[model samples]
Target: MLLDTFGRQAVDLRVSLTDRCDLRCTYCMPEQGMTWLAKPTLLTDEEVVRLVRIAVTLLGVREVRFTGGEPLLRPGLVGILTACARLQPRPELSLTTNGIGLARTAAALRGAGLDRVNVSLDTLDPRTFQRLSRRDRHHDVLAGLTAARAAGLSPIKVNTVLMRGINDHEAPDLLAWCLERGYELRFIEQMPLDPQHGWDRSTMVTAAEILDRLSTRFTVTPEPAGRRGSAPAERWIVDGGPARVGVIASVTQPFCRACDRTRLTADGQVRNCLFATGETDLRTALREGGDDPRTDARIAELWRAAMWGKKAGGGIGDPDFHQPERPMSAIGG
Candidate 1:
């Protein structure tokens, strides 16, 4: 296992297939989408698979997650998943998507060795969905969820960002809908990863607020700490039944002490933390390949060096915190 200076093991790897997304979520990007990286600049399928192989075989990474502006937008996603699944002692493969294009691809993706999925759906209201995403794909997302379940993607996770006075009022409705459908729902606190840098802490909903609202309609009991391991979401049993919900309190309760995840951008930059300001360019080294063993060794060294300096936390609530230049989409949310 690769241990950083803080004694945190790097066991989870998040690979960004592309920086382009189909939806323009207000909290993620501007209404007018930003310019995207050129096709040649993005890592090829072969390069991505090679990096994952090195991480899994060499670095002690046990879980591999595919993320992007929208992972479904990548053309070679299925092939990428197939390649990653072929690894010996296969890492747990999952994806995070906006679900706009998942209806047609969920089955194919599962067939290609995808274990599960996390779909981002903030509101069930059509008008609010359109207003938040700057697009009308609410029906598409619903269809995608149905198709995902039909494809046997067990425990499909739904990610919802609760914004004050925006979708916060619908907490009970969202939880009930997920419980009825048997999907794991997680409410995420809005962070400062937007490209426009307009994140106002006051307008962001805290985990306490989320619990207080949900407790009104359901018996919300806190799950034991560490049940989720290094995972971000903190789980809770809803109404004392099998149904449950989670709150990713990234802002108020930072989980940096147990953070074991590292990120690789679509352009091949390795980031120790999601909000990291510095990046190690692995594309240059990979493209200059000479000996396979030598290049793999160099990549491992770069990954270790990057994680060695990882800060204790994302610092979202710190007084001196500064949002990264890249938006959440670019950072592989």
Candidate 2:
């Protein structure tokens, strides 16, 4: 197993397909928008597939999650999924999308071997959704979720990034709506991925606060993590039905000690930690046109180097330590 210095086994990989996003979420992308990564800088489908195979075979990776500015933006996404499904020890493949253009591609994605999906939905109010996402694709997102359900993506998860004074009031309402629709709801504490994006610690909310408010209405019982490969959300079961709620407290309560994730940027930089400064560039090795053995050596070597960058904790509380320059969108939030 490819265990990092922190004792966290690198079992799941989040692969970014592109740096270009259609929406300009207030917290994620700048109002002027983000600079797109050059086409050549992004990994080709073949390079991505090759990397995944090596990661699963050599590094004990058991799950692979495709993410992006919107992974659906990649024209070769279906082919990528098909390649992932063909890996020797095929990892549990999944994708996280904004669902802007997912309405038509939902069935195609499932047909191409995607195991499940997680859609980003912050508010049920159309106007609020538009303001938060900076796009009027809320209806498309809903349609996409509905289609994903119809296409057999079981236990569909919806990620809601809560911001105080923004969507905090929608928590109870969001909960009721999701439970009624049979969607697993995960409320995430927004992390400071970019200082330029204007993140204020005072405006941030904690997981405990979310639970405290939620419990006043519904009795929440601790639910087991249940599976080996899962996101860093302390699961809970509401009083009624099998409706499960998850809370990801990345900022207020960092999960660095238990972080089991490794991220590969669309530009082929393997990052061991989300808030880490340094990264190992895999593009250089791929561009050299080496044979299989040489290429694999470079890949493994890069993995090891990045693993050395892992910290016991992210030190997110440090007032002096600002986040790395990349925005969450560029890092596949």
By lDDT, the best candidate is 1
Q: Give, for candidate 2, the lowest lDDT window spanning 10 residues.
A: 222-231
In model 1, where do residues sit more than 4 Å from their true spots?
A: none
Q: Estimate candidate 2's alpha-carbon lDDT, on a 0 to 1 scale.
A: 0.83
TM-score versus the correct structure, for each prediction:
0.98, 0.95
Clashing pairs in 2: none
- Give the per-residue lDDT digits (tens) of candidate 2, residues 239-302: 9547789999887877677678889999999888788777888878877855657788678777
- Note the residue pairs that clash in candidate 1: none
Count of residue pairs whose backbone atoms collide, per candidate: 0, 0
Error of 2 at 178 (Å): 1.0
lDDT to native, each model: 0.91, 0.83
